[model samples]
Target: MTDATLAFAHGDPHQLRGMEGVGIAHDGPAPKRIVTGYGFWIFLLSDIVMFSCFFAAYAVLLGQTAGGPSGAQLFDLRSVALETGCLLLSSFTCGLATIAAGVRNERWFQAAMAVTCVLGLVFLTLEGREFASLVARGAGPTRSAFLSAFFALVGCHGMHVSAGILWLLTMMAQVLAKGFRADIQRRLLCFALFWHALDIIWVGVFSVVYLLGSAV
Candidate 1:
């Protein structure tokens, strides 16, 4: 036989011996884990692109007050500041949840995630109330181009938070049922990244849409 064929014959062509008797090792590189991470990152990038478009639209319409209420007149800086703090704290707790997951501390992970979800819900509630109050005062999105843009930007973010809350609950269920399996851990990681990204987006909203609105 040729040298190549001899080597292949003698060297375990299937390369299965190294993984013999080890179930986890037989799994080999965990393609699911790798793909999960990659797919989640791609999703996050796409989400960032979507948010960028919203930001650009807001920028284009920032000054289009159209004889309606301006941001300074409609925005409540104190409320915005409170919402910002809640989101920031939720982001921090989400980080803690991820850390707990990594350590396989299911209790801490679930608690942290629960806290994050509650804070996210509170933020959304405040935002909804603000919108309702605006509409009650005749400052709805249809009132002007600026209000339209404002509603689009802030409302899109609230929707994201709502989605995150749903995801958090789902993850909690998974943790309770599965005890932080590898796939569950991967999903939690993705959720953590998404939740934190929403917090960062809210920071931008508060700064550009609220703080600057107050100043200008």
Candidate 2:
């Protein structure tokens, strides 16, 4: 048999080449956990890109208030600060849940996840109230370009939080029913990533949209 044929018969054909000549080495498919986490990261990055566009729009329209109420006139810093606190605390609880999941401690995992969900809900409630108050004050999205962009950016984030809460509940149910099978664990990892990403995005929103806007 030829030397190359012998090498191919013994192991991966790609390994026959020198290090510099070889392409990416395939050591079989990546584990489900890694694959799942990587795919979710891609999804999260895409979501962030979408949010970035909204942020850019908000910035451009920030001064185009059409002689309507400005952000400084409408934004309540105290309320926004409270909302930020809830979301940030939820992120901490999410980390606890991920740690518990690593140890397969079902009780602790569920409790941490529950706290995370509650905090997320609290954030949504505060945001909903803020939106309602603004609308009542004739600051609805249709009133001006500034208001429209603001609603599009902040409201989209609120919707994401709502979706995350639903996802959190689903994860809890799956754990209760399946007891953290490998697939479930992989899913939990993805959830943790998603939740943390949302928290990061919220930090940006609070800094740029709320703090800066109120100051303006």
Best by lDDT: 2
User: What's the distance in Å from true for residue 29, model 1?
Assistant: 5.8
Task: Tell me the spans in candidate 1 whose CA falls farther than 4 Å from its real position.
Answer: 1-31
| TM agreement with the true structure for every prediction | 0.84, 0.87
List clash counts for every candidate, in order: 0, 0
* Cα shift from native, residue 124, model 1 (Å): 0.9
Residues 116-202, candidate 1: write the lDDT tens digits.
988888898898899999999999999988889889989999998998999999999989998988888889878988898898888
lDDT of 2: 0.90
TM-score of 2: 0.87
Error of 2 at 100 (Å): 0.5
